[model samples]
Target: MQQEKESAEEINELWSLYGENRSMEIRNRLVEHYLPLVNIIAGRLAMSLPSHVDRDDLIISGYFGLMDAVDRYDIKRGNKFETYAGIRISGAMKDELRSRDWISVSLRQKIRRYESAVVELEGRLGRSATDEELAERLEMSIEQVHHLERQINAATVIPLGEYMKSEAAIAVDTDPHRSAEYIETRETLAKALDELTEKEKLVVSLYYYDELTMKEISLIMHLSEARICQLHTKAMFKLRGFLANIDGI
Candidate 1:
C-alpha cells in the first residue's frame, strides 16, 4: 500500500464526492489512503514499548482509530485532517497499551516515589538531579536507579504527542482554568520542556513534532534505540512531574 499522503486536491476531490454521495466506496478509499499513517504511528509507538508487545496488534487498534477519524472529521474545522487523525491514531494505540498494562500496582507506587524524589532533589539542588543524587534520595543503589529507569521506560505509555493532545482537550472542557491559570499552564509547560537536556528536547521534537520513528531519530542523533528511549523516558518523567503540579493540567 502506498504510504504517501495524498495531495490536497486529490483528497478534496475524494472528500467532495464522499460528501455529495456518502458512498461506502469513497470512505473506504479514504481509509485506504491513510492506512500508512496508522502504520507510521503504531510503529513509532511500538519502538518505545517492549519487544514482546505485538506491533501488529497496535496497528489493528490504529485501524479503528483511523476509521473513527474519517467518520468524525469535519471539513469545516480548518485543521489538516492528517494532523487530527494522527492524534486520534496515537491516542487509540495508547489506549490499547493501557489495556495491556503489565506493571504491578506496587511498582506504580514505587514509580511515584521515584518521581517525588527527582522533583524534591531537583528543588533542592536547583538543577536536574543526577543519577547518584537520585539514588541517595531514594536510598537505592546506582544500579537500582538504572533498573527504575528501565521500568519507567516500559511503563511509560503516554508519549509527548498523546500528553499534549489530552492536556489541550482538558483545557477546552468548560474552561476549567481562568485566563491567568491558563497562562500559567502554558508557562509551566514551557518550563517543564526547558528542564530536559538539549538532546532530550531534540528527541521530543523529532518524535512528536516530526513524527519520526525511533530508528529515524537514532540515525539522526547517532544513538542506539535503547539510549534514545532512555532520554525519552527521563524527559517524560520531568514533564509529567512538573505538569502534575499544575492546577488545571
Candidate 2:
C-alpha cells in the first residue's frame, strides 16, 4: 500500500515536470523516472500477444509513446501525465501489431464468405453443418472449407480498434442540432486523437474499441490496473484540452 502511494506521488511529480515545458534536464529526469512504468506496460503487452510478436519491439514502441505523451500533455488542466502516456503506449503497441500483417485481405474475404455460408446453413438446417457438408455445398475441399472457417473464427477473436468518428455518419435527419453538434465534437476528438502518441492512441482503441476493462487491459499490457486507469484519465484530459485549444482557434 505504501509502495503504491509512493509510486503515485512519483508519477505526479513527473507530470509536473513534463507539464512545464522545462529544459531537457527536467525532461530527461522525467524519462528516467518513468522507464520502469513504461517497461511494465510493455512487458504486459508482450505476454498478452502471441510468441510471434516481439517483446523487445513492444517495449521500444512504448518508450516512444512515453516521449510523445510528455511532449503533448497539457499542464494547465491538472491532468496526470501517466494517464496520457498509458494511452500513447498502448496505441504504439497496436500500431506495431497492425503492421505485422496477421491477416491478408483475401483471407478476410474468404473468412467472410465462409461465415455467411455458415449462417445461411444454420438458418436452413437449424443445426451446424459438418465440414464435409459445407465443403460439398461450397464446391471446395473439406480441408479448404475448414481452413476458411478457422480464419473466420480467428478474426472474431481479434479485437480491432473502434473508430471515434462522428455519429453524423450514422444519424437520421430528425435531430439537426444534436447531430451537428455530435459531428463537430467527433471531428474535434478525432483530430485530437491524431495528435496523441501512438501508444496513447492504442490505449483509447483498446479501452473504447476493444471494450476491455482496465484490469483486462493491464493484464494484456503487463501493467498494473491502477496504471491503466490513470492512463485513461490522462487521455481524457488531453483530449478535452486539445479540443478546447482547437475550438478556440
Candidate 3:
C-alpha cells in the first residue's frame, strides 16, 4: 500500500511538470511512472478483442493514450490524474476496437431492436424473462441470445474531459458581458448532439439524461443488458470524437 501511494504521487508529480511543458526528464518520468496503468487497462481490453487481435498491439495503443494523458492532464482540476488517465487509456483501446469494425451499425441496430423486444415482453409478462424465454421470443438460439446479450457490454462512455477542462465553457458568470459566451457554448453543444447517430443519441439519453443502469435500461428497452452496455460504449466513443472537433463546447 505504501509503495502504491508513492507510485501514484510520482505519477501526479510527473503530470504536473508535463502540463507545464517542462523538460524531457519530466516527460520521461511521466511515461515510466504511468506505464503500469497503460498495461493494466490494456490487459482488461485484451479480454474483449474478438479472439483475433494482438494484445501487444493493444498495449502499445493504450501506452500512447497514457502518455497523452500524462502530458495533457490539468492541474486545476481536483480529480486525480490516475482516475482521468485510466478512462482515456481505456477509451483509446476501445477506439482501436472501432477501427477494427467490432461495433458496426448493423450490430447496433440489432441491439436496439432486441431492447425494444425485451421491454415489450416484460410489459406483458410482468417479470424478467429467462435466457430460454428471451431466445424463444426473439426467435434466436440460446447461444445466439447469450452472444447478443454480451455484446451490450460495450457502452458509450461520456467523455467528461471537455466538461472538466473548460470551467468557463459551461459555467455561468455573473458578469453580463459573458452571457453571450454561454449562449454560444450551449448552441455548439446542441449542434454537436444533433450530428450524432440515432444509437448514439439514444445511448446519451438513456445513460446520461435518464441516469438508467444498463440492466434497467435493457429491461426498459427490451434488450439484453450486454447490448445496452455496448450501445452506450459505442455512443461514448462517437461523443468523444465530436467533443474533440468542436471548439467551444
Candidate 4:
C-alpha cells in the first residue's frame, strides 16, 4: 500500500513535470512509468485468446493504448489515470484482435443469428431463456445449439469486454457525467447476474471479476476447462441479452 501511494505520488509529480514542458522525454517517462499497466491488461486478455495469438503482440498493442492515454489524460478531471488508461489499453488490444480476426463470414453470421435469437426470446419472455427454448426458437437440434455455442465461444473476447467495460471511444473524456452511464451498466449487470445459474455465476465471477484464467477456474470448480468455458459463454450471453433489452446500454 505504501509503495502504491508513493508510486501514485511519483506519477503526479511526473505529470506536473510534463505539464510544464510537455517534452517527449517527460512523456516517454510517463509511459515508461505505466508500462506495467499495459502488461497487466495484455496478460488478462491473453488468457482468453486463442493459443495462436501472441501475448507479446497484445503487450505491444496495449503499449500503444498506454501511450494514447498518457497523451490525452486530463488530471483536472478528477478521474484516476489508471482507470482511464485501462480502457484505452484494453481497447487497443481488442482493436488489434479485430484487425487480425479470423472468424469467417459464415461464422460471423451464425454468431449474429444466435445472439439475435437469444435477445429476441429474452425480450419476449421477459426472463432468461432456457437452452431447450433456444433450440426450438432457432429450429435447431440440441446438439446444433451446443455447437453454435462453441462457435460463439471464439467470439467472446471483446464483446464480453464491451459488457464488462466502456469502449475506448466512449471513455476518452472520462468526465463525471459518464459516471451515470457506468453506474447504469453496473446495476444492469448486477441484475442480469442474479438470473444466472449458480455454476454460471461462479464461472463469470472467477473468470472475470476475480481475473482468473480458465485453467485456474476449472481447477477451483473441479470441472474441465472446456466446461468452464461453456458456463462463461452462457453467462455472458445471458447478461448481454438482458442488457440489450435496456435502452441506451
Candidate topping TM-score: 1
Better of 1 and 4 by TM-score: 1
**Candidate 3 global CA lDDT score:** 0.62
| CA error at residue 10 for candidate 1, angstroms | 3.5
Clashes of 1: 0
- Candidate 2 least-lDDT 10 residues: 157-166
Q: What is the Cα root-mean-square deviation between model 1 and the actual structure?
A: 4.2
Q: What Cα-based lDDT does every candidate model obtain? A: 0.78, 0.60, 0.62, 0.78
Runs in model 1 lying further than 4 Å from the true structure:
1-8, 164-187, 212-228, 245-249
Q: Candidate 1 residues 13-119, lDDT tens each?
A: 98878877888888998999888899988877876677888999999999999988888676654557787788778878878878887567988898889878877
**TM-score of candidate 1 to 2 decimals:** 0.78
| lDDT (C-alpha) at residue 165 in model 1 | 52
Give per-residue CA lDDT, model 3, range 1-99, as digits (tens). Answer: 223333666666666667677678777666676688888766655554456677887788888888777666666656666767776686677677667
Mark the regions of model 2 whose C-alpha exceeds 4 Å error after superposition: 1-14, 104-110, 114-249
Tell me the tens digit of each residue's lDDT in model 2 across 9-67. Answer: 67676667656656676666666666776787776555445467677888888888877
> For candidate 2, what is the TM-score?
0.46
Say which prediction, candidate 1 or candidate 2, comes out ahead on lDDT: 1
User: Ten consecutive residues with minimal summed lDDT in candidate 4?
Assistant: 1-10
lDDT, candidate 4, 94-122, per-residue tens: 88988988677998898888878887897
Which is better, 2 or 4, measured by lDDT? 4
Q: Score residue 191 of candidate 2 by CA lDDT.
A: 84
